[model samples]
Target chain A: MTTIQLPPLPRVAPALTCDPAAISACGADLLAASAQVDDLGTFVAGRARVDDWTGEAATAYHQAIAPTGRRADAMSLALRGVAHRVEEHSAEMQRLLDRRTALEDRQQHLAQQVAHLRAEVATTTEEGAAELQADCDRVAGQVQAYETDLDTWVSDLATEESEMSQAFTRVLGADDVDRIYGGVADPADGPLRDKPGAGASPAEVHAWWAALTAAQRRAVIAAAPGAIGNLDGIPASARHAANTVALGRDLADYAHTEDAGVLTDDERTCYDNALAADEARREIEGRHDPVTGEPIVAQIYIYDPAAFDGDGAVAISAGDLDTADNVAVVVPGFGTDGESAPYQADRAATLYESTRVLDPSATNASLFWIGYDAPDNAPWDEGYDGAGVVTESMAAAGGERLADTIDGLRASREDDPAHLTAIGHSYGSTTTGHGAHDHGLGVDDVVFVGSPGVGGDTDHASDTGVDPDHVWAGSNSRDPIADLGNHGWVHGETVFGAGLGDDPAEDDFGAHRFQAESTTRGGAYSFGDHSKYFDHDTESLANISHIVNGDYDAVQEAEHLHDPFLGPVEDPEYDREPTSPTTSSLTP
Target chain B: MEVVPVSVGEASRAWDEQHLDLDAAATQIADADTSGFTTHVRGAATRFLAQWQRHAEGLGTVSEQRADGLRTTIADYVTSDEATRGDLVALLTYTQEVR
Candidate 1:
């Protein structure tokens, strides 16, 4: 009979000598350097477009500078590739080190057990000795198992190091740089050759993006930032980078042309739009994170300075959309455009803070999505033109774009979906209503605040493609715009008959109406209350934050508008105490 | 020779300004920090930085040369214009005397 032999136990687990912090720091340094190089490249490209300088000397200057700009771009790409690999390597090393520490602790415990078992065997008598010996053998087998695990762990560490080295070698190769970024002077000729068609769904765009290499992504961003900056399926970080680059380039080019006195009226409008976008981004970036005191992240998710006939389109998010646990998109109504987006971003930031204050552990993101062309003028303005007239056609068109954006958000986060809420204010509520009723805006909840209407065809919450129970509305009693639907009554008789649609705050509309009243201003018919729903220290903002955090029970319910002829009429709640004591007395 | 519709002073100033910009750019590139990378990555980055610095210096040198050439050309054009004006004035005076 043959006995199976067990290998001797390892005395100790292998040590991990690499410092993950140092590795991570190095990665960060590489990224910083890469950004600097990219800036230099942009500067060179702008300088090369010296249209005012003419003749043979000008041609020679352009020819000399163009190649240098291209080289800068290639160098930037190479550094970024290396930085990405280094960061990934650092993360993997950290994970491996953690595993190694746990393994070492286990081995130490087993080694102590072996010593105890051997001591017991030495001190026991004949029968006890046999039992002790068996215990020793069992411990020995465990040690052998531990040895095998350590061996595998050590091998894995070596393999990881080898793979990292190989990756660095490939990223740093001169030929590799040329092959990736050299040929793509114009993005259309290189990385963007296989770009998905405009009609492609967000999922298809996401798939196409995921298939590209790091080098390819860098090339695309360097070559054609404007093309992909507003593309729906791209990640928020990438979009932010691309948009920032595009904005910088445009500002430089336009400023140069303006200096030369050759800027067209259209170019001036676009330049103003770009400036507004930059201002919004700067304002959001200046805000601090509620929990960490770090600067809050702001992403320019939509930036088309020339869209909507120079009224332009822009959307800014106040947090990291990709990783947030809850995301709230606040859509604005009439009189909002690129110029007013900075103010809208402030509301988004306020909502983000309110959500964080309510649930400190939950990660939240909020966006001021002015992605659609709202009526450019307020209806109440003097000599109001019919161009800003409330019409169903504009709402219908806006709804299509809104639906596409929401769908894109869902598709981009399929692996880990956030609890998304869409809040529409004033005429924007009509757009959101049509988006839900016509295109099925798939969201966890839909909110209409101070709404003029929901939709021309939507009569009930159920028709908005969301569960009737999940539909919510906030209409201050003093808000005049909130009464522009079937809910408005005159002398106990319905005066406004579903012109835009049934008011979302109407009892028959089947939506939960939340208390929304002006806290600072008191009056029965203050038109100013129409725009105060998002003000801090107000019930409206608090209740909206609760819904966004998915704390449905915490939402304070208000009586919906009902006819006085039927029974005792219910007046809207007013002058309620603010939900949080730490609320700031800031206007929206 | 082709007649160039060039503003000589403006063109010369522009070349001089470009030369300054190219020199500043080259200096910035040279001053970029390439340390803190992993051993192999550091080596690669050092090599790339060196190569780029050389290229930038080359561009800066060329820009300086262009500026110098433009300055000399501008001086020559000014001198030749003055000489031609003096000769024209002298011939006009001679014709008036003959009349």
Candidate 2:
């Protein structure tokens, strides 16, 4: 007989005397009360009622029902997000259990086959018995494989089980379950609300979150998981659990739209972007660091995928960002999304491991933040608006989002705020540069890897608002992309907003230079080469890790002179060049 | 029980190939993978593959922890998500286009 466990259902607040309809009724009652007060005030105003009973404040008093009126909509979003998430968790748990049961059933079937073979072997002739024994041997292995499968299934189930437990009230005593279901009397005192600045600052969110009881917190999560998950200062686990719920709903909607077969082109794009975001979440969760044996701390700090004309923004962390002692956020250059995100995450894991190698005891979280829509990945258009297409304007546009992400991370940080470093690769370096140069993101260090250029007007490391000393750059001497930045710097600022400053690798650029491997083919590195600054065996990767850990002295210096006269070092493996600036209209 | 030595480079390539195939085959599963007993099997398979990917990678960095990790991957793979019952076979048809 197999043990069959049903999926844990959503916690039923037995005392939820307020279903959505009931909540609306309550709001309606409040509205009615307010109107009655208004009527009395009107009578007083007209002097048609009692003396001195002027209803001067009656109309204003009636406005007290506004929050109640708004609560219905807010509660709906919350309930839907929670219910969908609970359903996902339940479905996953049940699946794991069922799969395990299937394996066990297979195991039993094989075991019975082996048993039958053994019985036949006892009764059969020598030749038949030998064949029967061989059958038994094969069947025996199947039984063991099934047994092993079951063992692992149980272990994996624990992870889902634990997540579900947090999502629901698994550890609660019967009395506590009754009380949890009974629910809190006044949700107004709860942490969720749409106040003037409900999530304006991490400190405020922290304070509000701290004031709630466990049950209240659970209730708030159930009602508004997305708001809570997106909220600053909440713990990583809570946010992940909450966001998972929101994501499930979004995915379901996406699936539904697809099923309906009426998705607009825009909706199709949104679906792909949403799918990418979902995959990114999965990446951060079970993956391990390339260097460290520790479980990767995947946190979805921000997941606004449908923002900015279908180019969504997302931030994923490899470790707990809120509590870590050191954090580095990598903004990918171009063509980054759920699909391209694994590469960026791979870079983060590499950097994370390198940091540990640099400082054995450092608690770190490296984030792959594709939090802004970069230039679209496509060939240049008909007219190459040198300034408009793939210009620093894209970075300039993305500056605020980058700033907000850092600000949110900063706000959510625990006591003794983490030493944070922001690094940008390829075009992302410009975005990072501008985020500092323009938006004033507070970071301990800023590193530019394979940068196309900083802004046209911006000169020197200090321009990025990072301490000039902490400004860092790494570009392979043979890297053509870095070379393009050198050309723009050498060409002088061409288009006002489009132009980028001098090459940070140059001695004149004033950035502390680091070595990068230019060994893809010969000594020269091209566009494809530009993408591998964090690849294994590259000195650039080690230097980046050192910078993140604040081990400045350990950072390696560059090799090979970058004089314009240095010319092409050798034939590149994949010598792809950017289109001429005059005719170019590309975004990637 | 039939263990394929999860060589990191090969496994990484496997992951990329699997994703590309899944990207192409998603519609078939997305239509029917929403509910029913099959969904449970799919979810288990999906999660197990996640664990398996992790376990395969762990073989390099933390081979000592192999037993625990491999157990998860093997089980999940048994009930893993597929476009059809022959998802793995279909995946085999797609070659690794790039590294």
Candidate 3:
């Protein structure tokens, strides 16, 4: 009982002329045309079929055509009639051939048009892809050009900013600063924001960051965070950061050589001498210790040529710069010995010189480069030169020699015993720590730069083994050696000591350490490489000067702090303060 | 913790009594007669010890509180003496057979 159903035909597009009246009219015409074409086709086909079917009749008609006279007359008529029928059939076959040819031509023409259209579409698609590729390349070129331009612009802006900072700092010192800026110079002048620079005194610069536009202030804040507190007009945090940036920018600019506001002649002389003394070049003599009977060496360089020159003048506060009130000692690292190059001596001398140059005054400040051991190529030289030899035996010997050296200096300058600073770089720092540990040496500050180990910490006073309340460190990210060497060795108790609460080093390690800001992290000095603390023009020199002079604020302001290692200390006891300070005392 | 302490007077007396005899022994050190060496050494030691003793005298009221500083100075002098003696011994030993 299953019913069969026919599939419906696919719907066709609405008839081209679908209006009822037009459709009816066109239908009659279409039917008539179709009928005519069909009738012509049928007639041609039927004639061809009949001709093929009746070959005998065709022969008979051909025969009769030639037959009789009265029969000839009749034959003539019959022949004529037969000829006419043959002519009619021939004409119909011609018509059918013509129609078939037209239909074939139309189909060929349509296929050709379709092929041409496809070729055009392919060409257009290829062109579009090529255009897109060209656009991408152009964009990349523009990006690279922009990057280069930005770099150049930033470099130029840095230079300009430094100059502006110096100029503004000078303006801050003027007696009638308000009057000068009230309506004078350029259009940048106006009422001070929140009465800034209005009550400024002429004695010394009091952190008076000059008036800056909002954008300029934002740039400063971006450079050094938390520098300037918010002024009346600006947010407190943003302003504070900007001010800090301005201070660095200003001081850094003020110290620049090409800048307009650099130190004057007399001022330059003071700074030069101090820098020279700080980097004083001299021969360090190692001899048998009178006490330990061991070979001991003492650094015999003068911190100041003034100590040698009687006519030298000393000032306390030159211009906006202030001399350090305290003193510091900087011990040179490994490879520092009498045989070290003359540049070594220059580097040591330059440290004192740069500090004096920055401060240009004498407020009980001095620095020393302790070249206690002969220079060796490696920190691990086997026979009396390496760390192993030093730790096992030379340390005690150096300690004795150091004690004697300290005693000699004390005797020579008994008048000023209170303000002394000691700085140590690399292995020299270890030597300084030994001196402090074994002799109970008295110093205002002990600073270590590029130190491998000093066996002490500033934060854990008990574990420090040295008693100096202020211990500073300067390890710049630029110094590769700071991260090199045996990191796993328990550096005494603390993995690393507490920094002087300032950032001079740019790495995270710098945050936990102290740094010298006035000088750039990696200055263009020739001696900016490993163990080049005494190198001339390097920030290490400035750092040494600051430490010995007890410029705590300056060191803190450098903004070079960071902390790379954050894991909790493994052995806290090593960093814990000792129960009694005197217990670990090496004296009696 | 209960280590016996040496008084400055006692230490000084012990050094004084043994001073001459020690000088004799210094001459006979390392199986050699260093008589000439002993005289110079004794002279230097005398001057150094005398200065040290003078300094020690200035440190008054010896007790645990004050003794540490004085003791450190004394120990330092003793260490110095020992070191100097060690140096002299090494040099003297080298020169003994030649003499």
Q: Highest lDDT, which number?
A: 1
DockQ of all predictions against the true structure, Cα-based = 0.07, 0.01, 0.00
Docking class of 1: incorrect
Indicate the docking level reached by candidate 3: incorrect
Top DockQ hit = 1
lDDT of 1 by residue, A47-105 (tens): 43556556676577668667666776776666666656767778988888888998989
- Where does model 2 exceed 4 Å of error? A1-190, A194-199, A231-236, A290-294, A337-339, A379-389, A486-492, A521-525, A559-588, B1-99
Candidate 1, residue A30: lDDT = 48
What is the model-wide C-alpha lDDT for candidate 1? Answer: 0.71
Q: Which lDDT values do the candidates have, in the order given?
A: 0.71, 0.55, 0.34
At residue A436, give the lDDT of candidate 3: 61
TM-score per model for chain B alone?
0.68, 0.25, 0.24
User: Candidate 3: where are CA atoms >4 Å away?
Assistant: A1-328, A363-371, A379-384, A387-393, A456-469, A484-512, A516-528, A532-539, A557-588, B1-99
Query: What TM-score do all the candidates reach, one by one?
Result: 0.62, 0.57, 0.31
* Candidate 3: Cα lDDT at A112: 54
Across A400-509, the per-residue lDDT of candidate 2 in tens digits comes to 67887777677666566899999988778878888998888779999998877766656778788888899998876566777666441254456544445566776656
Residue B95 lDDT in model 1?
A: 20
lDDT of 3 by residue, A274-359 (tens): 44322222211122222233322222222221211221211111111112354444555555442232334444334444554445
